[model samples]
Target: MRIRKDYMGFAFLLFLAAANHWLLIPGQVLAEGSETFYPYLLNTALVILLPCYAWEIWRSRGRNDAPLFWEPGLADLGRILCLLGGIWLWADAMKHLGFILPTAFFLALCGWLYGEKSVRKLALLALVSPFVLYALFTMLGAALPQGGIEIWLSPLLVR
Candidate 1:
């Protein structure tokens, strides 16, 4: 069977997922109950899903009769650059602004850049989602990186 580029990429990911499930995830669990459960559950799901992905990729091999694709156009390149720039900005801002503010801004900026013009919905998502994620991760005992904003808010957050 001839191995196409798409097949090679899918196989690489499948191998990676399986390896992480078997090797990395088992050592990373620090707690015996909830902390252990999520990682194992997710890794098991990925391990199961990856085999199905591999099978589908194998089954569909060489089905695309299209010739080798041309290089992406300048517009496509510009959008890719814009996405990278946005991500870089988000990371830089997060160092000082913390996860919540930068993530909200990043989400709103991404929505706008991708042509989603619903201001109300974007605003709601921008305002609410980050706080929810922060709370969820805190509840799950994940140590979020603290920035200036988080440092300031830590006193209020302490129970």
Candidate 2:
């Protein structure tokens, strides 16, 4: 009997879920609080959801006959490569430039690459999102890498 392509993908996801619970989460030395809660919750959710996904895949196996992966055209491939390169540059830039600037720049570049033509909207998104994220993560007790701007702003942002 031939196994469906969707089943293979499901199996890969199942393996990742198992790895997350058994291999990844076990190694983390979590503090006494909700830090441990999220990972276990994620694992539990995956345990519940993967079966449902598998069932859906099995139930609709006959209806779908798509290939294992879609082939992207040259333009699509170029866009994907540019996005990846942008991500790499963003990460490197973050060390020197700080979270907000690099993130804003990356967001703007991504927006342009992904066909967001409105400069005002892109600027708003690029500028506002990093600050929002920085504030959110700060409130959540996550330590992000800091540069001059972050160092200057930390007094106000961090409690």
- Residue pairs that clash (backbone atoms under 3 angstroms), model 2: none
Give the lowest summed-lDDT range of ten residues in model 2: 28-37
What does candidate 2's lDDT look like per residue over 67-134, in tens digits?
35445578977998999999899979987888889999999999999899999999999989999988
List ranges where model 2 is wrong by over 4 Å: 1-71
| Positional deviation of residue 63's Cα in model 1 after best superposition, in angstroms | 14
Residue 41's C-alpha lDDT in candidate 1? Answer: 71
Cα lDDT over the full model 1: 0.70
Number of the top candidate by TM-score? 2
CA shift of 39, model 1, Å: 7.1
**What is the lDDT, from 0 to 100, of the residue 125 in candidate 2?**
94
